[model samples]
Target chain A: MSEIRWDLVKQNWVAVAANRALKPNDFPIAKMGLKAPAAGGFCPFCEGNENFTPPEITAYRPKSQANEKGWLVRAIPNKFSAFTLEGELVKTDSGIFSCYNGLGEHEVIIEDPRHGVEFHDLSPERIETVLNIFKERYQDLSSDARIKYIQIYKNRGMFAGASLEHCHSQIVGLPFVPQENSGLPKYYRDNNRCLLCDMLAQETASEERLICKTDHFTLICPYAPRFPYETWIVPQRHCEHFADINEEEVRDLARVLKKLTGVIMDCLDNPSYNLVFNTAPVNVEPEAGYHWYMELTPRLLVNAAVEIAAGIYMNPVAPELSAAMLREIMS
Target chain B: MSEIRWDLVKQNWVAVAANRALKPNDFPIAKMGLKAPAAGGFCPFCEGNENFTPPEITAYRPKSQANEKGWLVRAIPNKFSAFTLEGELVKTDSGIFSCYNGLGEHEVIIEDPRHGVEFHDLSPERIETVLNIFKERYQDLSSDARIKYIQIYKNRGMFAGASLEHCHSQIVGLPFVPQENSGLPKYYRDNNRCLLCDMLAQETASEERLICKTDHFTLICPYAPRFPYETWIVPQRHCEHFADINEEEVRDLARVLKKLTGVIMDCLDNPSYNLVFNTAPVNVEPEAGYHWYMELTPRLLVNAAVEIAAGIYMNPVAPELSAAMLREIMS
Candidate 1:
């Protein structure tokens, strides 16, 4: 489980997970983009090694038992979760600092049962199943009054912070809305327009930063990317929540994601990357200005002090160039 | 040099450094935290290899000629700078996007001629010299009307994004104030109190999070630290600019920094770290609420999607515990 603490100076909440020292393997010494060791030996996410992990919370194993080997996908609680559901969500003051019990849910979505499979190699059907699980979890977690936001993300390689060499994604249901989402609702209230929608219209129209487009989705390198070869997969229509996505959107997203990720792996020589889902908070009423999107950042370079101190990013590769390269590869 | 791009969607500015791909050495494939390859082979930052880099911008070489091997500390324009002084500082709108010619200064401060020498190993007098160079550069750059903020940071070890093995620091002058500093002045205006001064009072009074204290400065693990073992060196008295540091403060800071960094290396077994200096923007009038500080973050864990998307940090090691460990080691 984890405890949430309020940063008095920065005015933000920090989740502190316990038992981090117990998992020494999570902190790798290797440079991030290298191929992680195959999970053939003592792999927890492997189908037969289900016993190594905590019991399954939910799985798409229609034909097999709850914790059996016949599942295409599975969901389990993170063993060393940053936030947990054990303690009551009570806020306490320690001098000038405010802290809450580590009260939230942390779950891992096993993309596949294979030992060393990557998400791009997964079949569209399997990816769709993963998307379905994400939506299901988002909906279920939103029902809890205590959970304000559910963050869904995937760390592909060691550099992107993937401790286990397995095809998996994480879902953290937090007790408070993250700082990034705080100003979004107000923007919608003031402008009556979705910021992403306006940007997407311009990006697609220019076609300079657009990598690919499908019926329901558009993929483009962001104008001001934080990392080199940073890409975004945005829904064609404005949608506030990931759970509100339709079946067509899900299927299209799966196909687009598979193609885009394959291109990224090929273009960047299989760079370590992080894929994050940005959606509106559950507690807030869905607003027109809030649009759900996914940002894919390739870990091509290391972040230095400028990034940490100023919140300013220095990207080496221009988005236009990266997008042109991806477009050429896709063609 | 670097080009500045505006992220209309996120409402932030990004610096895009060009010619990055030409320098493959900047992107190392070896595992982080490992002893980088020694300075024996074609080390651009080494003293004798002055021809390998651009001519020195400024150096402390009193006995030796310019571009010669006689300097103890040297300053040079970054060969592959993210932002440069080559362009006119003009912002133009392209559709919904705004971009400016990357019109700023980027310099590298060679801390020592020896390769693989960490900051903690340096003598206090040498550290003071380095601090003097930083203040000198800050004061010099502030005279340029085009520059707003000067970011001083050091990326040590491979994971901390130090591409070169030699001990050095970077200074980047930007055309605009970063998003992180934008709120502080307004907060000060509204509350009529210096946020950091209040924080220092609370932290020093509590003593739980205080790692150490000198006559001029206090080192404490912030109550809401974004990373594990994150520490800040804050001055005892309120100071808005790094250039305002006096001779005595510089000497004390050098001593405190040496001791604190040594404690960190001892406690974390020489973990990769990033050290950053945060100060008020030059364009703004100095305010009582704005206090200058330096932050040191150890790269103990990898940041995944939740951190990137939500702006929420999950620190596994609590500040209090880490502070206590450092205090114990110091004793």
Candidate 2:
């Protein structure tokens, strides 16, 4: 029977129709459509092609060079940024419409020095270094009084909206907090507890939707996923912002990310995916009942009109089945 | 300069970055990838293949018959339905999760008899008949005490999520009012006006985003569109439900839909698009502020993680630019 389930945190309904009978083997591997870059293709994030991109804001380098090469991980301004750090955050209203000057930061984090190495292939400690850089950027951007929120994410493949084929992540500093985060306050008001912490306890204890777990972090398939095989990595401890992540938590998160991605890649053969961070905003109110988490949604199917209009996500495969398959594959 | 605009109705932010410099010609024609079914493939919606589907609930035929080859338009239960009208609408809660038994209706409206002919190719009179049938279905589904909302939409081409190549639309009778529609009450409380009514007046008066207008309806590019070339066809009258549409209004609406879709098809080179209808729910309150409208979103680019997570839509081609191009092309 199909079940219409409510997502507590996202505040949306997901219709899980198990009768669709989509087993693990039935899913299409999106990486099959992903083409490798042409031989000698000019990738801006490549070591020698650093001149093609904006100068590095920060880099993990042994030498004192800025952008000329020899950096393990690099961070630079996006060439085609959606937001810029130039204008004042002045808001204007015209009848029913309102707008703000897009005064924020958009930076790209190049994952590795080698062009072909993906983030999932890197060791957990190496990934932890990248995680540390994300935390540093979050903290650094938080100090900017104009910025209200920070969004960090990775679009992994061509199908996942990655313009550049090179493996890189993006950190966007937004002038205002988004309306989608209203679920935080809604959940907190309804139940005087941290949303993700409660969800993490529920998901782990149920064990039906548990994919994998580490010392500090646990990966679980959400009960009401918007997409099939949608997974979330929640920390065991309650934290308000991702920038507040400690070194040990970062290490465990890195380990959990690598393990979960490995299992998902093997399960669906490296499907085009989006890795998104969900954290508390810098200058937002009701700051106590927020918990930071990460969502990894594999781009398996296109969302139809019903999804775009009504916010009713149609997930054919049940999360319990998907989590069971993921656990089996991981073992 | 780029601006982060607020969408009053959708409660989301749209960052319009003209720096990306996407003009009318920059978008790719998604229909280039949309292949006609096959030389001799079996299409259930075809004229002689009436037996391939479930018996028609209702169809427009010259003579009295249930399922026949002479039907112009047909409505039938979805073969692989997401919701079935069976069992009771029982709501269950466990821990932080809540769910309802999927006891609702899902129907397919085959638009035309001929397989080669598309909806855009239909004459205004012919399209009006389809609109009438949609209204009839809406009214019929409203009588179901368990159903709460009826979402009518057309997912055209492969990218927009049409499984079969037959030109058709779907009507889903959901058991609950979707959470995306909170804007209706929010608008009423904040401004003491209907959202679409105010937006219609603003767009028509400004003329900056107006694409076309008719006696009973108007088509305009929205202030903060989620995707580039996104358009809305809103009725001029202040009706809460599309089911309340009169004969004259339906005829004018058909004309408006035809003209707008024709302009959009020409503009985007027959892009794969989703045609979604937004109206009041059947079994919900605060319906005074609701206004019925139709949305047409052409699928041009894959939304990245920032869009999926933070609900910040990135539209490279500003609505003003797209609307001007559309008007110019229409003239």
Candidate 3:
């Protein structure tokens, strides 16, 4: 589990995920494609090698035992979690500074049983299973009064910061609402309208940066993307909470996600990318003002000094050009 | 030059520094140490190869002609600028969204004539020259009423986003104050004290994460560092602007910076790092409520899904431990 500390100067929270114990040289090179076997000749998430990992919390093993070989997908507590299930959420104040004991859940959803397979390579059924697990976990974690936000994200390659080669996504239940999402609620209050919904309508009507559209979802390169080939997968209808998504919506999202990932892989030659789900904070009921979405940022460029210092992003490729390239490849 | 566009949804500005038409495959591998010669066998920043870059804005060439070989340091307009000097500060409104032409100055400060030498490796006089040039440019650019902020930053290696291996730093004059700095003025108004000055006093008294101390500066790994081995060099006095530094302060800064970089390089084995100068916005006079400092972040870890999505950082290494390790290496 991770411990959250307050940065007095920046007025933000910093999470120290100390369980990983990664040293300065522990970071792996940004390698693409398949990864070699572990030193012990074991892949924990593999079907038969399930014993290598901790026992399953919940798994889709209809044909087999709880922690058995026939499972297609598995959800387990992250071994090197940033936030732990243990520890009391005690906030301590020293003068003007404050810190809290990192009391939250960190779970890893093994997307597939195969070692070398990627998310896009998984079958639609498997992808749907992954989405269902994510939704279930979101609802379960939201029940906890201590957990305010649940962040579900995936890192596909080395550059995207995946230490393990196995296909997996993470769910981090945080103690507070993140700073980035702090603006949405106020924006909603000021305009009685969901900002993303308005932007989606404009994007769909313009059809300039639109990559693909489905009955349930709309995928487009954002107008002011921080990175090249950055895409957003948003629901056509406004919804505040991701857990509120229905069965039909889940299936549609899975299909659209597969198609979009395929397009990105084809266009960027399997570039390393990160997929992040942006849902509303917990304890807040579904509202008309806030809408949930997922943003996909391909790691084509490195963020350096200017970005770190000023919080300003300098994108070398225009969003219009990236969208056109993706569209051409999709056709 | 780069163009700035307003992201109405996020309520932030995005800079499209599209002058550098970098392709998807243009990003170089994370190469360490000295770079190999380019295929053209010409380094654009080398003293003799002045023609390869845009004309010099200013250079310390007392003995040679302008744009000739004998300069210790040079300042040139970035050929691949994100913001140009030509555009009018015109804001256009389309529905709820707003955009403005990127009307700002982007210049590159060639730190030294030698291609392979790092900033710390340069002589103190050379480093002082670089600082002087930075201050000169900051003072010059702040005179423009349209420009509100000037960011001074250096990306040292390939992973740190340096396109070329030659030693250089960048100065980007922006048309507006960045979102990150917007909180400072308000915080000052509410608290009646500068946030950084308060932080500096606490950090110095604790001295737990202190790396080094000088007459004019105190360097420490911050209490809540976003990255491992992240360090900040803050002046003891409550100076709000970098341009306000006198000659003695500049020389002291150059000496302290060289020592700190040497410590970082020794501890991390020449890891890629970014040095960013945080200063007061233009037209803002020096005040007790706001102070300026430089933050150094080494690119030892790759930021991925969770960090990008949540705006929360989960650092594996603690600042105290990193500072202790750096202290040991320094000793």
In candidate 3, what are the lDDT values of residues A15-81, reduced to their tens digit?
Answer: 8754444565565642332355856566777778878777888888779998779888899988877
Comparing 1 and 2 by TM-score, which wins?
Answer: 1
Lowest summed lDDT across 10 adjacent residues in model 2 chain B is found at B22-31
Interface RMSD per candidate? 3.1, 16.7, 2.8
Which runs of model 1 end up more than 4 angstroms from their true locations? A18-26, A30-40, A86-88, A181-190, B18-26, B29-40, B86-88, B181-187
Candidate 3 — what's its lDDT?
A: 0.78
Candidate 3: tens digits of C-alpha lDDT, residues B174-212: 887775545466668889877777777777787677776
* Per-candidate interface DockQ score: 0.54, 0.18, 0.54
Model 1, residue pairs in steric clash: A2-A102, A31-B31, A32-A159
What are the lDDT scores of the predictions, listed in order? 0.80, 0.74, 0.78
Q: Which fraction of the native contacts appears in each prediction?
A: 0.59, 0.28, 0.54
Clashes of each: 3, 0, 12
Name the better of 2 and 3 by TM-score: 3
Off by over 4 Å in 2: A1-37, B1-36
lDDT of 2 by residue, B1-331 (tens): 2222222212342222212322212222222234356888678889988899999999988785779778888999998676668767675576776555666788999999888787888899889989999999999999988888899999886557666778899999887777555676567777788888887888889999898787888888776677667788889999988899999999888887787788767767666689988888887664567788888988765667876777666656667777777778755
Error of 3 at A188 (Å): 2.2
DockQ of 1: 0.54
- Give the lowest summed-lDDT range of ten residues in model 3 chain B: B27-36
TM-score of each: 0.93, 0.87, 0.94
